[model samples]
Target: MQSLGPLRPRSTVLVKRPWLTKPFNWRALSSIPPSDYSNQSRGGLPRFFSETLPSSKGGVIRVQGDEFWHMTKVLRLKTDDRVELFNGKGGLVEGFIQNIDRSSIDFVALEDPKLVLPQTPQWHIFAAFGSLKGGRADWLVEKCTELGASSVTPLLTQRSSTISDNRVERLQRVILAAAKQCQRLHEMKLNHPMKIDNLIPLVAKSKQSFIAIAEGTPLVSALTSTTKESSGLIIVGPEGDFTEKEVDLITEAGATAVGLGPHRLRVETATIAILATLTLWSGSQQISNC
Candidate 1:
């Protein structure tokens, strides 16, 4: 009742105090504009591989070795930055950098990771190509992953060139790099080199399979008309292509021989062409059904 400036009107006091009528806009208090972090909020950010990335959130993931050098030296990412992570086994997570060091990086998972389903139904490519001369094998692995091949088996056919053990290791590195670059959650499986005869049984088990041959039914026709199976395999032969006896063996194993084009393709070229053809055909079929 002590006259406070003649009771300066309760309504005026409420109007002057914004908190009385409106809630605080916390987002507007951010120092960095919303657009500054737009890329980090989306799924198309640069990805890194951590074989041990946890499916659930709250664990710290360590990035070491060449990946560390890449993030620190090349990309120059710093603390508190965000990155996309994959485990090369269908696990994908968005992580926030917690710490960095000379040899490694530690990031904390912010939320539950996502599992990316393969684009194609478990399609395997039993590529029996010869040991490519230069960097062709590396290129083949990279392109094959982008084209949606689930796995690639190197076949040591009768006509294949000599492949050193180091070559396979190098090719595995290429597969990993390619998978990360293409944002493929599942890394394409790279099998040890095996003889052509040893691969027939694997082909026989596929629900639908094809062998890329120079003179056979058109690939598109075969793929388009085939029953949609859960699993399939495509066999690609060496540089000189599979011999008559080898062809007979594969045919007997139930793989339909399909032709890619009129002209013969090199081992790498043919591998990509066959895989690309199948990927497109399968995608079209899915869209039509949708």
Candidate 2:
């Protein structure tokens, strides 16, 4: 049997060559390596797939685009290579690299994954915050994923400086990578950017909503006083804060005004705090299910 030593972190390209190749009885393989898989630092989606080997098996999920590039180029993975696959389904699936070429690679799923979906009451953390300056919006999206935000909506407010350039493809990668690392099976819903005027109409459609004001009502008190039977929404303003008219419009639309803390936080900070609190609350309710 031939061996391929532990992967070099700095290796640039993995090419196919007889001398560089190793042999293994893929059919005899029993499990995935512990060193190659991790479920920490994952966020955004409850479930996602990285371009690497399958962690385990079941019905396969969709993973297209750049992920296909990683499989074909970076990994230098070839057909029949034994690999690992995970789906955040509470189990791992052992698979074989059945198809591999310059264009794509498909793993034949073999076993069940280990991570299962949460069965608790769903918490819909919807945010309507002003877009940030330069690349700050990207940073917000990445961190928000880790904080367990289910969806994020960029809001255009009077105080916001400029609208962000649409880079949907790049942003989606950040979310996908986070989800794979955390073993989350679901994806974060990212809504298109819209003005506060358009957002007001949707607020009335929700049964529960909260707007995080820097100084209005305390976060805990506001949340505890509300009914927990339905999913909720939270709106955060830009660094300069929401305009008086905007706040009143949202309030009249049924959004409860709430505060995050005493000190004022940046747009991203406030958004993450809201998501973290909601995620914790949702996770606690599902303790018995986990």
lDDT, candidate 2, 101-143, per-residue tens: 5555555556644334433333344344444556666777776
Per-candidate clashes come to 0, 34
In terms of TM-score, the best-performing candidate is 1
- lDDT at 65, model 2: 50
Off by over 4 Å in 1: 1-42, 284-290
Tens-place lDDT per residue, model 1, 23-133, is 423233213222333233245456787765543466565678767777789889899888887766556677887888767787777866665443444567777654677
In angstroms, the error of model 1 at 243 is 1.1
Model 1 pairs in collision? none
Worst 10 residues of 2 by lDDT: 1-10
